[model samples]
Target: MLMVMDEPKPNHWVFFSVAQNSPDFTLTIVFFILPHSEVKMGLKQTIKSLDAFPRAEEHLLQKTQTGALVSVIGLVIMATLFFHELRYYLATYTVHQMSVDLKRGETLPIHINMTFPSLPCDVLSVDAIDMSGKHEVDLDTNIWKLRLNSNGHIIGTEYLSDLVEKEHADHKHDHDKEKDHPHIHGFDQAAEALVKKVKQAIAEGEGCRVYGVLDVQRVAGNFHISVHGLNIFVAQLIFDGSKHVNVSHMIHDLSFGPKYPGIHNPLDGTVRILHDTSGTFKYYIKIVPTEYRYISKDVLPTNQFSVTEYFSPMTNSERAWPAVYFLYDLSPITVTIKEERRSFLHFITRLCAVLGGTFAVTGMLDRWMFRFLEALTKPKRRKETECGSLSGDGCCFGGN
Candidate 1:
């Protein structure tokens, strides 16, 4: 059997088929092609059918005053919530975690800025001693001294080496002056005159300001400023007595490590004034190691601390020096702070919740208010009867 279809038109297809063994078997196929515009329209319609939110025609839709008010209120609330969420999304937060400090052979850097209005730069020395018996005497590296006058003004600045060289130059000048004028003064008389001159200069109100960094082992230690570099006899001769040495000082800044965000050093801008008596001012500090991790994954190593202070006055019988001592120890616990931001998915979730909840609540309120207004405006029906005996059926009439 064979079947044949008509000739194909433009944008159309026709096919014919025949079976070899059966005379009654036949097949026919036809395809009509659509224009490109119609194809695109069909595809768009298919996609639109999948939309869950259906829109009603404007002519068929009815609007209510209550609904309009509710929409305005909802819009305001939605905008508020959106801005709030935006702020929360853009903001970064800090998370703190604690762990055991396991680092080995690390050094702690200490920055100090101190002003001693009562101590002169000539006799001031900085010394450090650790629990391991490592002693640093007359620390000179990376240290600076500023000579200040009575008005708290910087008159000169020098390091330990500069001061030593200056002193040697002065001694050579004195020796040459003695050689030139042989009968003027002996070496002993010149030495006495130099001491008297030093005392007079000190009485004219010269102060010292020390500021620098010191690196030490990560262990318990004590650092102090005193007249330890000079012999006891010379120090006593200069100051008249150890009891009269005024250790009054102001600590401008003190920190154990490089500062990061939110690092608070407890001893900054601390002023200790000792009046009329010489004493030792001791600050006992406990240091906590800290690590700050930025959002960019940069890590900053730092430290934070708290301190306690004690003052021990010198007794007449006690043979000791007046100084300012900073005693510090380390904590085994390490604190880590990290900066983080809210995730995008979290922001999306909050936005959805805000929109959906506001829509549902406002919709319910609008509906209830509309129904209430409708009930109030609706006319009530009344029944009335005018009866007269006329026939077997009763006469009744009523209209509302």
Candidate 2:
């Protein structure tokens, strides 16, 4: 359905159209009190009525329909949830393709020296604020995330879009994990929500921090994270070298690597950061860090340190959830960077398991409900009543 309202002074007309089976499929009324611009509340409502949030719902969802309408709404909801998962899954696919380099069984040990271009890597003083997080894991390994790369710095104009994309006003990172390993078999839609929460955490700077050489360096910002279904902030610090800070310790000790072989072939991907005068740097995001050592031809060691080691994608995860907060294993502590590809792949496999399982479970539920709806369309057979002859003695005896 579409509506057009004309306002002569502005020489403009408002156009509003509602989808056939959407919740906001009927006439909508809105009120606005704006003194500055000519764009009134009516115009705002019209625009909002047209912009369906897809998987999300408005405060007042259409609820009049009883049978058929409900079915349609359910179907739409299913589609939106699936799409949300697909978008994140695709995003992970892109990240995974750009970072890892190894076959299923290939091995690369740590403790090797490597050399790369001596280009000047840009540096920045970071101030990380964890909107949500939990330190339920072991004290030593509390902030571990399961990804192929480390927490990276943004460099160059290439990553400006991504940097902007990940930014949000409030970072909420309390993603709950069930006891299910790798992936849960059901609740695919919920999984999508979880992925979103994780992304928000990472983008909003859950654990990102920096410390200058000063007296105040003893304090780390509060990281807001939920623990075992409780909302709380994980306190950490970024200290001067003389005194150790909690967040600084985690950042310095954390390790990242390849989840699989062949994620980036030819050579270990190199991430280059060019800092211009504008206090911003440029980055080619899909490249690996300049830290791996290629001993002879076939053997390689990956334990070396490079600046860009923080932003490679060696595994397939829907978003950067692991990098943001503390991940839970049976034990709940974050693990350090692995020296071999097997360890990395194991972690990546677990992450993919979660993502794929989420998609599959939701898809199945959607299909099942659709099938139920189709069954409802079948015509019901009615039974006919047969009248036997009345009692013989009565006048209504069977006709001869």
Tens-digit per-residue lDDT, 70-94, candidate 2: 4565566556656664554443221
lDDT of each candidate versus the true structure: 0.77, 0.29
Candidate 1 lDDT score relative to the true structure: 0.77
What TM-score do all the candidates reach, one by one?
0.64, 0.16
Per candidate, the number of residue pairs that clash is 0, 24
Best by lDDT: 1
lDDT of 1 by residue, 83-128 (tens): 9999999988999999999988888888989999987887787776
RMSD (Cα, Å) for all candidates, in order, is 10.2, 32.8
